[model samples]
Target chain A: MMSVGELLSQFGDKYLQALWTTYGLTVLCFAGALVLGIAITVMRICPIKPLQWFGDFYVQIFRNIPGAALLIVLVYALPYLRVMLSYYMCVLVAVTLIPSSFCSEYLMAGMNTIGAGQIEAARSLGMTFFQIVKNVVLPQALRSTVLQMTNLLVATMLTTALASQVPLNPADLTGIVTYINTHAVGGITAFMISAFFYAVTAVVIGQIGNRIDKKVRILR
Target chain B: MNGAHASIRDVLYDAPGPKAKRRIAFVTVISLLALAALLAAIVRRFYVTGQLDPKYWSIFLRYTTWRFIGRGLLGTLQVAAASSVLAFAAGMLLMMARVCRYRVLNAIATFIIELSRGIPTLLFIYFFFLLAPQFGLQLPSFWRITLPVSISAMGVTAEALRSGVNAVPRGQTEAAVSLGMRSASVFFKIVFPQGFRYVIPTLISEMVIVFKDTTYAYVVNYADLMQNAKVLISNYDALLAVYLVVAVIYIVINYLINKLAATVERRTRAAVAAAK
Candidate 1:
């Protein structure tokens, strides 16, 4: 019988590729979601009536939808609608949309926390609306948002495992995990190893988030 | 100054300005338009493509699929309830261990809480599903396997409680110890109540996490609502309708959870104030 470590060593190539794909897909989706988030938050706060309603509705709908259902809707439902996206694109849509909803809410929360006096000050100084938002509001929003964003990112990365449901089962950490569970015989050992890997990733994510939160608090 | 302030006006509500009104109206219109468009597109696509009947999901809902989804819903509640209670009890034990002053017990508790704090909660659950059976738990397939899953979860909740304990200002525990109270009594009576108040918000947040994360139980074929929804989507043609319904369910449950948490938070605050 092959030793457990030796058995694990054989799948190194597959494991490495899965790791890259997992991280790459996660970063791209999260970045896109952030843009969507910012747009929605801005619209919600806009002086224009229609834009604010659009933003509010978007948050309420997305917030209600479970992340898993959203994933399925994007992946399985869209194709049925004749939108022929590849599996990866489907996963991206689902992941990005969910985060966008959360990010918008977070941005709104951050914006609310900014003192109204700053905006009034900017207005009296004759700054244009854009200038006031850029100079006075954005900086404060960023301070609060940075920590919240980090927390969301960590959560998103963990949730990315749900992407394994895509038909392709791209060679990411989660995919590798499912593969090992089905193909390998070591049973709990395989599970433990994969979980350990995830736990390590989580630790790194948590540490990074905590540091940013601390830095922002110190700056304030 | 007294004469000038003599006639204070009574205010019931702050009136939003015209701009705020405009903003609200605009956002509402745009939002409805977008949702309507999404619904329309879904309907149109269903009509045109002909891959499956839009009525399949509705029919499914009326029959055996209904049972499956209902079962799945029960599963969702089961895992969430089990894990939350597990975390609470586990956390209490861990908190006790951390406070025990024995170096070994303290070390074990610290390591577990810190480790769990760093790891993603999803991975922790997945890990437990894989690892728990080895520990003789033999959880039914529906229980969502992996022994360490709840343990890790408990670890996080426990750590939250520890912080709650710390926030008790350090003197309360000391005061309890000096008043001829046993360690157990002091923990359950004096420290536990106060610590719970401080941690209630985080606890509620954790429950939300548990509720949402149970969806991950789908991957292992645990038949939670999410998995049931997916099976429904695949089995029928009313794809968007079924998915929409699923979304509403999550929102309703989550809203209730948040409301419950808020109620608890209020009671705690009232108690704190009353004590003061």
Candidate 2:
């Protein structure tokens, strides 16, 4: 068994870099997914028939495929279409789009729970459709679905590990583990360190989400 | 109230006038055309690259290809099935332990659940894969994937089962105990069955998640579907075709599982209503 000090001295820098990549990718993906999710939610709920069908189709297709497979497809398939992107960018696009589908569903459920009277009131006030959605609907919808959205965020964070599969930019923790396993003497110790980082981050995120949930919860 | 109020449909937007309808139709058509053009360009690229070559796809028709796919599919299914069953049992045990009267056991269960849930599934697999060799455990590669998948899944499964058990009415358990039933009997005979009924749909969906997660076995060089597809991709250089087929298989399997879950859920609801 490697001592804790020995483990840190040997693999600390790589583990730290991996931690940074994991959190950085998580933040980027979460933000991108939120924006895309809101658009998808709007498309699904808006009065446009074509948009609604498109949103439904998007959710059905993306949500059904496993994230790892989807990542593989995007990484390999995009170049064929003459669309070039770095491995990081490819991962960004795939991770963002995949979880956005679920996030949109959760947001739509929240939107559905908003009273029709609220929309009616906004309409009576001569609010435009976009205005009503932006001002009146979105805030309430988000507030109600914060916990679900948080769950999606954490799941998305976890999926960032799949990005390590991309050979070009394999900086994520899982990728780092694979690297360490081959090169380092105490590979198990190094992996445990990475696991510890991930586990701690997950716990912290859950706690923060719980705190935000309590703060933002709508009063009945 | 005297005048006809606008219908709810009109509240969001006035029914599109004839001109507005025409404009919407034109925009939709243009967008569809653009999308079609993009897809055509993609197909054209494949055509030019020989990726659409019949020779490339012919590999799927060969006996060896089928054997490879069959073996990979079996491996994936075996891991998924074994992990799900083991995880379900472990989850139930953990949930039972968590809910038991013993404080220390409850704390230990909670710690395990949180630690397991907090760690990503891939990390668990990696940890076990690396750890096994160091400990001189000459286990098969399948155990490496199965053990980690099962352990990671246990966290989620236990959480689901815990919620299901908690949702059961307290009175049912109390009544079972009042009948001079032992604690285990009260739990197993009365509470667990009812709770599990409420959670069957969720458990089924969790199984689908486990099935999808079997792809992570690729990390350990396990010959699951994804790993097999990777090998084929390298061998044939038909990356797009190989991935597309893999994605389609996954989508079809998941779609079927979802439909099954929905049907089971409806049947369970109907059964409950009938019992009432």
Candidate 3:
């Protein structure tokens, strides 16, 4: 068994790179999820019945599908359809799709909290449809969902661990741990290092989210 | 829709006037066509790639295939059920520790909860799978998957339980205390039972999560549904069809669980309202 110092000294660079990769994937996937989530939310809340159904269906399919199954489908099954994607792309897409559904659900719950009275008031004020969404709907929804989005961000990071399932050039944090474990007997120390990074990031995100929520929380 | 229960979807737009109604109708038709076109394109791809061939899907008709999958599903259910029970027990203990008078216990509980919640389940599985064996702790493949899945769910379950406990009114505790009940007795007798009722829905949703995590049973070489699907795929030479069916099975099961949670939630809420 290697000492923690020896492991760090030997593979510190790999760990750093892996951590960076994890961060990059988490941020990119989160951005992608937010964009898709907002679009789905728009579709779900739109007056068009078909679009609403599509959005609802999308959420149900993605949200309930296990991450492993979704990733396997993307990585293995898609090639059968002649739609091959890079390993990184498959991981990105899988993580993004799952979290986007959750993102939309949280946004819907946030929007629901705003209640109908506010929308009615906005309508009475002669605000245009776009204006209500822009000025009234989005601000409250986004504000109230800060905590959820934070949790989602952590969840997205955790989901990015699915990257270890596939081969990639520069693997994410979890992948790096697997790399170390396989190449050498990294043991609990290697796992703990990765877990520590995740825990710190989660705590920091939670703290920031609480601060924002405290500041912007709408008192009803 | 009733105003009291109107969600953002219902209230986002006003009751449409003639002009708005016409515009909405036009857009609906356009979107419907767009969705249908998307669906057709997917089916077309499946056709072009020979994925629509009966050879790939015919394996599903065999009774043995379903039995194999059913056996795998039983494995999955067993893991999920075992892990859920373990997680709930640990979670409740963690919750009690956190709310206890001992500061050290509270801090330890909080730290464990945060670490458990923050770290991914795969890492936990790896710890048991790769790390434990290093120290001469050999667990069965089932435990390798089940233990990690349960541990991964523990923090969230603890938080959920704590939330439920908080939702139990302060007056209940005070009243119990006034009746000369010990603090532990008050918590056990008057408080926790109500708290447990309030969080049954949350706990059920947690089960859905645990169920999903069990899919990683493949890593530990456990023959859960996905693993069984792999076996069927190998035998039939149908990877896409088998995996797709397996994925649908998972999604449908999780969906049903979620619906059950929502129903339980509503029923409990109504019960609470009636009591009030």
TM-score against native, each model: 0.80, 0.89, 0.98
The local lDDT score (0 to 100) that residue A145 gets in candidate 1 is: 82
Quantify all predictions' global Cα lDDT against the true fold: 0.69, 0.80, 0.92
lDDT of 3: 0.92
Model 2 native-contact share: 0.53
Order of the predicted models by DockQ, top scorer first: 3, 2, 1
Better of 1 and 2 by TM-score: 2
Q: What is the lDDT of residue A113 in candidate 1?
A: 63
Please say which candidate is ahead in lDDT: 1 or 2. 2
**Comparing to the true complex, what docking class would candidate 2 get?**
medium
Better of 1 and 3 by TM-score: 3
The C-alpha stretches of model 2 lying farther than 4 A from their native spots are A80-82, A120-128, A167-170, B1-26, B48-50, B58-67, B178-180, B270-276
Quote the positional error of residue A135 for candidate 1 in Å: 2.3
Per-residue lDDT tens digits for candidate 2, residues B58-108, read: 888889887887788899999999999999999988998899999999999
Candidate 1 lDDT? 0.69
Model 1's i-RMS, to one decimal, reads 7.6
The true-versus-predicted C-alpha distance at residue A147 of model 3, in Å, is: 1.1
Model 3 clash number: 0
